[model samples]
Target: MNAPFPPAADVGVPVEQPMLVEDADAVAWDQSTDLLVVGLGGAGLAAALEGIERGLSVIAVDRYACGGSTAANGGVFYAGGGTTIQREAGEDDSPEAMLDYLRIEAGKVVSDETLRRFVEQSPETVDWILRHGGKLAASVWKEKCSYPPLDRFLYHPDNSLVASYRARAKPAARGHRAFGRDGKKAWGLGKFITEPMTQSALRLGLVFHRYSEARQLVVDRDGRVVGARILSTPEGSPEARRFAKYIARANMLLAALPPSIPLASITIALGNHYLRKASEIEAKARFSRLIRAREGVVLSAGGFIMNPAMVRRYAPAYATGMPNGTLGDQGSGILLGMSAGGATALMDKVSAWRFINPPKAWAQAIAVDRAGERFVDETVYGATMGEHIVDYRGGVAWLIYDKSLREAAFRQARDPKLVPFQRDVTLLNLLFNARKAPTLDALARRIGVDAEGLVRTVATYNAAARGEAQDPFGKEAVDMHPIERGPFYAMDISIDSRFLPLPVITFGGLRVAEESGQVLDRAGKPIAGLYAAGRTAVGLASQTYVSGLSFADCFFSGRRAARHAARANV
Candidate 1:
């Protein structure tokens, strides 16, 4: 091992002081493996699978169970570079073209070389998932939607279709959602990917410890990370047995009841009770075990959006947004790496999504700030609009529309093609929450915006709709409906709006080697024997996010870390 380097300064106060580094020589190891993977989420599963493929003995630990936030996701895997699905859909896309768009979206968060490598590997990444039993439909959905409808499995989930990005590169649908079985409900489509990958890893002799959390990194005298201290509930323990039952019931309810059903709230609340009980039992029964990793310790435990303290400390602006990850997404992996001298980056970046489409007609509505000034192209990606509202508009905005536009949106919400959740939420927002008034000034007053400012903004927008001037925000003419009707409506699309909750995910964590996914210190040098992947490490979406980009990066970065660790000399 190399000589010990001085530990880097802590990246603010963590949710709690990370267990940091423990002297390897002072610990008694209960188990050992060539690679120790923390948090069996998408990234950890990928690393474990990859490590097993490379003939390395791997052991994985998860706080709850396998899946993590990935299992709760919409199952979209952002892939381009002429993937088989793209070709099957008759879409022309290449690594160069993909890079052209991503360069702008990613904004130099990663080196050009790293970004190019990511794009180049994208097609193979899709293939790798398929090889591991993950499914992607060949059909493409060409629509301007926040997310594809249940029947559609492929779409563009980023800024690629927007005018600005279309000019930079030919737009193509890149979100490849994992195929669900017939009669399957919408939501949590990610189970198709995570479940199969987990089974594949298990079948390949990967040792997994559920109800276990990695608390600290174990480092050799030379400051090389070699293992971890895991707190785990033994499989046969009373708490573990009870947790299995609770979690099984919870999963059953989650699978059976989509959020759109009115009774779903009560059933889901019961499911949450089971989950909470499971967590309580797990916490009570945990006992620490020292596990040595001969080659490397991979931290893939996800991000910190669920950690209130971390959210408030880092991306405070998004503190009020609903967190979108599992309970395990509390920055344990990132903090574990930080304790081992890992440098963090983009800690302030968060993806606060306030999607306004699905009832795609809603995109025609002009969004205004508190002062009633139009701020963004209504048809832009939801995250872009959300950023404008939260970062620039004091976390408040309203979608202003005439009665005709509102009616159109309501009609579209009734389309059978819309997912049940989307349809229900849209109907709820429009039918119950939308404020109606006789005039623009009255509408502004009803929604608590500047009345005169709203009137002027609408006049300017209507002139553009009538072809008297260019659209100020470059919104397409097709999405420009004049708001001159006497009956006007304003729907709150703000970050804190009760009717339209914004789901947020943190996009920041330990800075790592772009090539190998090795945790890097403040000096930009890789820490020997330590690696990080997924949200625990800064990757493609650290700067700005798009749907499926995080999942794709999980595959790319996880495999990179696993392969590098497997080949490294201990």
Candidate 2:
């Protein structure tokens, strides 16, 4: 079939991919290297750099730019198994503990071999990042937080939920943050990762082509992914606009990204800030440039968080919340893996919203459903609340607080004990959903809940707070406080956060082999010359989440795939 738009050749690019071209007699490869990488996010960067460190020729490309979703994130890399950082911070964590903890999160899909590799190779992966421009500190945090609260505390806090898991490993700090410069400046965690990784790729002499889109995977008669079709065009062009949809419908047509035009712009930064302007690093394309992968192709292009169709199909409940991914996370990577007979797992799994922890003071507040009756132990981590609300309350719940609790919430918002929080959103929630009433009945009427039920719930809670009766929900006394004082308030801290959506990322995608990071076929076989990493495949957070686990998996899976791919043809 002829392309609707006739394409032309992009200049100054050589053909480099590790597979045999079907039409080698007639078609000329735009660029050729031992390894051709698509997507320059953390996974892609890690993959490219891993190949380079092994002295293999490498070329990498991204649809938008080098930095994908990671650039916009608070880069948290989860690690443990007695790493130097953990040791320095005076925390004892064994590999078995990390495996135990992760097994619960990843569930049954990931193989035991993969879990072992993931736990065993984690420290080496950290070392690789450190050597190649990344930075992390060795300090155990003292407080319990969803994400890093005060630049310390890398491991998961000993949450009561984790304690209940069948694996039953004692909680330890494992999330590693990159503060960039001296490792003390707490700013862009993504930059700490993207900046260093990008520069390392450039320094290692890997060819980088930005603004080049991989439209489809080139398959030979043998039904294996050989290379990608490269297409270079304007961002909002008719073809580019329809690319994602077109790719999904006809997955094969989407894998290949042809060549592109020259001299647009190449922006580089040596550190946290922009270093200086330099020459343009361009990838010229004439027609859809067909560059064969001599070894293999990796899909680390992120998840489908931004794709409403995928969200609605997999998890309908999350269709209307704030998506925590970039414009490029349209599931092209997931689809690409699928198009090549790759079986996917956990597509239905998503962290629709993560409440984490709002404030220590708010722990004493009572959370109620539409009927105005307390259901959850409000003392649990905020991040853990979303699932319960979705399963039981249909995604909407209210946090009812007394004046003391409300005032403390405000204070904690201003000056958090563990981490600086978003005071604006907190205020917005209080200002909008919160109700101030002289009595529990009036507050219930104002908040649209059962008046009698609200009054009864409060009286029971107050009695429990006063230690007159055994607490019905097992809430510790430290988390108990009476709502006897009038002028009560309520804010809808539902899964959607009524005021603001709790930021969340999808944690499931294509299931790849743990040992090789190879994308597996539906029948549980490795497709030769094909692999996946990061959110593109099911890793670290196979289902549930632990702050930095996904990011750390990005680096580990990328490095793992590259380590195997670099040796695939040799």
TM-scores for every candidate against the unseen true structure: 0.92, 0.80
| Predicted structure 1: clash tally | 0
- Specify the highest-lDDT model's number: 1
* Model 2 spans with C-alpha error above 4 angstroms: 1-27, 148-167, 181-188, 233-287, 373-375, 416-421, 450-475
In the order shown, the candidates' Cα RMSDs to the true structure are 4.1, 9.4
lDDT string, candidate 2, 250-270, tens digits: 322211110110111121112
lDDT of candidate 2 vs native?
0.68
Q: In model 2, which range of ten residues has the least summed lDDT?
A: 271-280
Provide backbone clash counts, one per model.
Answer: 0, 53
lDDT values, one for every candidate: 0.83, 0.68
> Against the hidden true structure, what lDDT does model 1 obtain?
0.83
The local lDDT score (0 to 100) that residue 503 gets in candidate 1 is 79
Task: Kindly give the stretch of ten consecutive residues in candidate 1 with the minimal lDDT sum.
Answer: 1-10
